[model samples]
Target: MKSYLGLIPISAKVHRRQNRMTILCIVFAVFLVTAVFSMAELGVRIEADRLLEKHGSQELENLAGSTMAQTLYPIAAVLTLLILIAGVLMISGSINSTVAQRTKFFGMMRCIGMSRQQIIRFVRLEALNWCKTAVPAGVALGIMAAWLLCAVLRFLVGGQFSEIPVFGISITGIVIGSVTGIAAVLLAARAPAKRAARVSPVEAVSGNEKGTGALRHGAKLCLFRVETALGIHHAVSAKKNLILMTGSFALSIMMFLSFSVLVDFVGYLMPQYSDASDIDISGSGGADTVDSGLLDTLSGMEGVKRVYGRRTSFQVPVEISGAAEGFGAAESSGAADLISYDDFGLDCLKKDDMLKKGSDISKVYGDSGYVLATSDADSLLRIGDKVKIGAEELEIAGLLKYDPFSSDGLTHGEVTLIMSGETFIRLTGITGYSLISVQTTGNVTEEDVEAIRAAAGEDCVFSDRRDQNTSGTYRAFAACVYGFLFVITLVTVLNIVNGISMSVSARTKQYGTMRAVGMDGRQITKMIAAEAFTYALSGCAAGCAAGLFISKWLFDVLIAAHFAYAVWELPVNSLLVILLAVILAAVLAVWAPAGRIRKLSVTETIGEL
Candidate 1:
């Protein structure tokens, strides 16, 4: 060899089996960054097209630079950072275990006059060498995943995503993934490399260089069996390894909990109502000219599931009773938007659980002199307050959790009073509806829409929004969040399994000695299981404690701050699911290692490593 540096590739080649976990970590990190950024690019493209089509070029330009439009990049960046951290933890643990096993090899190099800097370079270069194959494989897998996601959005979703290219390549994604993979591998190799250089030649050559702290006391045998207690001791004996393993498991849970908040944020951002219409019919010039009888006509149609209409009068004068006067009533000249809902509309509201606590939907369902109001943070309106319109005084029997009309859940300076259609007609002396909405059956066709259009005549405006429902945004968001969660879970499980297997391999000689001392295979297996469980239990406790606070913080920032109606609650179901996953991972992690230990030839294992 020309120089000691030439041994780097040879070392990696000889230790290929042990290096697989490190390579996998790099691949996973690269894949995540590539897939996420690629999907973000596609999503931005799809959203831009939809906006450009809905509004003209001038309006599109205005919205293109808006804060909402620029949110995707920051979100993608955060996800990339999380994936990077996970990669570092997994890869570092793997390399540390490898170094502990190869103490003699590094010690020999040091004895042959290898400088510490050269040893560090050799270890780092060995790690980088694996990236030659890992990076390309990861990028390829990432591109395929992005293509698959695009296909799902375009074919299955089929709304605003119809124009997205299924097989498109994103240069930005490719570059970012490659760079992140290299960076993660380099960062992960640093501490292990330095530790390897610090290995003492005399201890390593004498075969006493097993990297573990001397125990200050014996295992607590009273609480557990001999085998289990020994296994727990083995786990806790290596303080660094214990920390790495626990951190890997805990980070996975934390990331899962944090990402879950995004699902709720998306729900609020594109709030979908249970009564959302597939088709809408409204009067021209914002007038209540559409016949209210058309609601019944559409409801009876063959392809219609249900129908509802609203009679609305904007900025109607009103008189507020005591305690209701703080709703900016005096400044706005006692004006509020007056709206009336039919039985079906009120039923939809009840089904959607939009009514706040203590709401009484029954009184507002009929011609009773009780009405519902939409509230915001600053409003002083409450249930049981009186709102007088003209000569009639209507009691506020309920309040909506938010102003459904406003995107941010705020009323934006105007109070809204909602009542039954009969009460509205009695108060305003108007019988026509300003807007009518139709819910369609599963097999609804254009013929049904045309029939309804013919019934309403050309005087009323018609809109078909079946393919443009906002629920698609929710589905897309859910798919993305769950996809990320699945990847994180896979990485966590693999890290746990790999770490346990390495632990088993490093302690093979010890196991063989125990076997020679008459410890049976079952005892050995129990010992391994105990070790795995120790790691799992510690990780679970730490993960859940940190995850709960992070989940709440994310919820407060992403959902609660902007939307007055949103509140954080304990995610019991999420906690249960995460705990179940961690338990399953621990079981799986123990399986292969225990089996290998059970099948080991005691004499050969003792003589080999």
Candidate 2:
């Protein structure tokens, strides 16, 4: 009679508490998955256009005629394949955790003479019941969510909706949601099912089942059990179980963080670079023209940072320091990328105040008693040394270089010469100067520089270095890296949500016990939320540290090996966003599971326990 009484609660409890949470989780998962796929498709279309431009191909014109599906299908196919793999693992972990948490209940049913198969059958039926109820409701809600969100949230770039590759409820959506729901349940059941078959009836009746199989060992991972009574008990008793959940949550956090960094890279340039070399001047439409004079007028403009200038027109014949000719090709570039002449800006040396000898050092002093030698140049020639450039010989007083490659991993560059405009003219005998670099005080407006340039005449062009670094290459690369990362995070979060949902399912009896002990349903819910919140924040903390370290190392390596860049500075706001995203995703993942605790029943839970 008691056993029959227990059945009534089990049947009613799931619909009341568990069903709502499952529906919420599944619906959110579908929405994210769809978004990832659609966004990827949009990027592919953009990439296709870029490739056409790069290869000088007419494919874009032809591509324009193709329907949106042509572009979307490739992206969807690839993303769906990748997301499914991760989704499967996450669902499995979640389902397994649920099964593990509920092992004692199964064992007690067996103590009543139920066969292993009967236990499995009951559990499977229970999972099916949860699914049958949740999947339909989730799909319905997901359709509504997509409808509402799409209506309000515009795409990054505007496009025709019916024309754009967007997803709505369809046969495919139903299939995906159904499959995903079932898979999570099936995967979650494995461990619990295994335990039910092998665990002894006496152990099952006890409900602890310690020192059996996987659960018997490996419990030390939980730190400071004293902080939370429940956590301490769980650490000691369910070490293996906690490990699984920890791994799942940690992975989710990492993906969330790394992808966050990638998005920032695309949205903004590094500040020092953005702030310094604030404007590039294309010259010769008129000589110094109004453009050159326009620069002086820029200081008063709003958003004007300090502005500086660059001119690379003076070329002096330079002899190699080591060998007779010294000037030769670098092996990496087939020696093709070498610059034969340079016209450095006077302000370049002045801005840094790097001059060690002669004249306000605003400009290079050629053949002076003291020569400013670059580290690379110094290595080639020593102090009091002379490097023959053309017919003039310059004395090496000190070593100086604007080492952009210091952090880029590349060592100092080979070419070495610092000269004042007067000295350069004396040596090169070239009366003309070209190119202007406007280094602003970080807040200078580009428009202000252009206005200043009008005075310098048509000969000068004012722009940002980023604009000159060539357009769209950085954009594409960033998109690809971050797009892949977004997909990974989406999978990670899904797994987390699934795992948390299973956790709630596994602890239904425990929740009921809390209610039995006079704990409010809301209080029990809060505790579960606390646990989920703890797991997420911990993972985010760790992931953020790891991500920052990794990206910084990568930044250093790229500058040294490739770009010859000088310093690497972190984008603080960007990193903050990344960490914030990790926490946000964690909170979101916990919501579905937390809600389930509010439906606990004292009588039903005590029976299960």
Candidate 3:
């Protein structure tokens, strides 16, 4: 051979089976990063098309300047960073395990006049060789995944996304994937390469290398049988290995929990309120001129699922009977918007969780004197407080969590008083509605929308929004989020399984010796399981603790800061699901390694290098 580097390919060829897991890790990491960026770019394109088609160039320019558009690329960048961190942890653990197994090989190189730097260079280059095949494969898979998602959005979800180009390829995705794959492998190889170079020739040649070293302490027998205790001992004895394994598992959990916040933010950004209508009929200049009888007429029409009407009186003078602490000092007179709701509208509020704590809907359901006020009406108005509008006194029976009419969850300097239609007519002596809304069934056709529009006549302003109900944006966003989450989950499972298998292989001789001394397959299986559980338990604890903080921070930034109505709470459901997943992963990780251990011949295992 011209140089020691010549052995790199030969060694990889000989150990290809052992290196396959490492290669898979690199491929998956590249795939995730590429697919995320690709999908994000496609989402932007699709949204732009929808805007240009529906609202023209001026509206599209306005959207481009909007906060949502400005934040889109930054969000994608953060997601890419998360994917990179996870990939590094998983790939580093795999490389470290491989180095530990090959201590003798590295030591032999050291003994043959190879310098420490040469050994390091050899290990790094060997890792890079795997990327030649892995990177291309990963990029291909990522492109195909992006195309598949585009096809789903374009053909399967055909409302706003019908014009999305399924065959469009993202050059940015390709370049990023190729670069990230190579960079990740190089970064992951650094520590492992350094450790490999540090192996002493004497210990390695004498077959007393670190991987086969005797335990510093005997397995404790207090908690379980000898086999299980030994397994646990194996996990904790190697501090570096334990840390790497635990970190790998922890990163997956953290990513899952952190990304879940994005789902909530998306909901806030594109809120589909419970009372949103497929068709709306409003009087000229928002006057209360639409007859209340129109509600029943629309409700009786074919394909109409439900109909509700609202009566609004803007900037009505109000008098507070109590301390009036809820009103600002400047607005002591309490200028408010008086609105009325029917039974269906009241029910919709309850269904949407719009009522604040301690709200009582029964008090305001009919002609009862109690009324509901928006939470922003006054900071100090509690249920049971009294307010006077005109000559009548009304009790505040409940408060809404937000102003459902306002998109930003703010009331914009006006208190909103909502009561039953009977109460509103009694107080204002007006039976007409300011606006009427209709919700149609899933099979609603254009003819149904036309008939409703024609019945409303030319006096009222009509709007048909059935196309908006198709939920194109919501589905596309959900598919992307869940798809990325699924990729993280798959990578995590593979990492756990690969790490355990490498650990088992490294201790083959030790396991064989135990089997020779009457340790059965079931005992071996228990021992392996105990070790896997140790990693899982530690990882879950650390991950959940860190994840909770990140989740809350993201919630504060993305949801709470923008929406006055959002509140943070414990993510109990996410915790339980992740815990269950970790436990199941631990169980599955032990299956193949234990089977391989059981099938090993004692003599061959003890005799083989």
Candidate 4:
């Protein structure tokens, strides 16, 4: 048993390519996990420090022990678990493919009286040996990555992020990465090691690891030539490999799309300055304070693109029949405040594409009766249903996902009913503008903004999206989220690389045989490409569908219900980028290996066979 240990080193050296790939997989996974954990931990620390500075150090002795730090711990835990799962699958698939290729070697060991236990031990030790070298290297890389990330964040956030660590390295992150990396390698190696131990001497010697696949009655033609068709068939014939490869590709796409949705979702739910306008002016007293004269002046101001105004009123009564189950709206009976928009105001809303349902306002100008503001409570109001307001019965023209005036006040628990200016006069019998929003042309300077502010007067309140109170904080959060997402996506790309590499390397002899039978280099490359195309197309399609479905549910649960904002739309740009990335990855995965095979002489390849 002691003597058999020598075989482990010998086997590793003999199959250095496979061993190198396995080590790379472990290294990349550990590196990413460590980097992400470190980043999250640093963020927690920085935030806690800020709190401590605000509340005093005696309030919380250690930043790590703070409430914010504790909250971050769970998020870190969940993210670590997800990364570990992906790492294990990636490492396991690489091992499985490599082991299958080395059946003959395993068989020889079995014939020489090496017990199955010895073989398993040998394989396990080899994996552990690789981890010994890879884990530390990965941890070091992770620390560097985390430091760089922190620096980038500091740069983007400027002096506002005074407490951000310049050289932060989390001890917990290193320990976690080492433990998870070692554990993942062991778990991933078990199946492949067992399979190797079970290989029979005869089967190994004869090089007959698998039986012939189910035969086709007739030759099936494909869009490509015979070589390409044969390659596609060969690729899909191995059900396990096909599924693994496709799944790897699909998960990469799915994660990218879903994370993109999450970013957009969070942005939408959070209170931010409107994208449609550079400056917003509101009446100091009430809805009637900002009049037509002020709006006209703002519209004609230098650098101003356009100006729009809305007449807003609070506590207008609208008849409600069946109140929603849990909205706590029974007290008000769904009698929301009324916000009336003029034609220009409606045009602004249309430009922003803020409507959640119903046709564009222009299409339903004269035909539509009223568009209701989105309600926090699940009110029993449907589009086209005639509901009685103060004095008139009007049809619910549409449902709005956004109303700027309502959102700012509604957080304190108020429901608003949005309508056109004509409807507001008919129902409330009052007509005066409350808020006047300003949109600037091209790039508006600080001087321009000041001029506009002066023109609006000191009494009027001006709000700029660029200078919003939470803009800096939001930028930091967005930067962290996007950086974390990029790391996860990179890990997935590594998985694809490993899966493709193993598949191609395992078929070395088969390729050689084809070469010997008169298949040229170009033909061989095309064959490999066809197989990649099949996998890429199938995987990308399935992943996109799954991602969209998940995004819908996520939007409903996390954003729509929580914020009472029902505008959930697909992140089309993100999905398109993902699709393009998958295609490019597939091409590179095939092209690289094919290029290597093309380098080897036909005789050399046949000799391995």
Q: Count the backbone clashes (under 3 Å) in each candidate.
A: 0, 58, 1, 1
| Ten contiguous residues minimizing lDDT sum, candidate 1 | 324-333
**In terms of TM-score, which candidate is stronger, 1 or 4?**
1
lDDT of each: 0.83, 0.49, 0.82, 0.70
Superposition-based RMSD of candidate 2 using all C-alpha atoms, in angstroms: 10.3
Residue-by-residue lDDT tens digits, candidate 2, 1-609: 455335634654844543444344444444444544434445445556555657657666666445444534543453344334334345445545544665566677778888877666665566556666656665665455444434432343233222333344445555665676566556655655565566557767656554433544432435533224453344235555565566555545444443444444443333123324545565645432233345456556555555443223323335544333333443211111111112233444545444333334422343342334444322343455556664655555544434332453232445444455445545555434354445444455667556655544554555556334322334434555565565455555555556666666666565667678787645555556656666666556655576566556544433333334344455566556545655666567556655666655556767766
What's the distance in Å from true for residue 297, model 2? 4.3
lDDT of 4 at 184: 87
Candidate 3: TM-score?
Answer: 0.83
Q: What is the C-alpha RMSD of each candidate to the true structure, in Å?
A: 4.8, 10.3, 4.3, 5.8
Which residue pairs show collisions in model 4?
370-397
TM-score of each: 0.80, 0.51, 0.83, 0.74
Q: Clashing residue pairs, candidate 3?
A: 326-378
Candidate 1 Cα misplacement greater than 4 A, ranges? 1-16, 42-70, 107-118, 149-168, 200-208, 221-231, 282-293, 310-373, 381-399, 412-434, 441-443, 458-461, 511-527, 541-573, 601-609
lDDT of 3 by residue, 132-156 (tens): 9999999999999998888887787
- How big is the RMSD of model 1? 4.8
lDDT score, candidate 2, position 433: 35
Query: Model 2 — which ten-residue stretch has the worst lDDT?
Result: 332-341
TM accuracy, model 2: 0.51
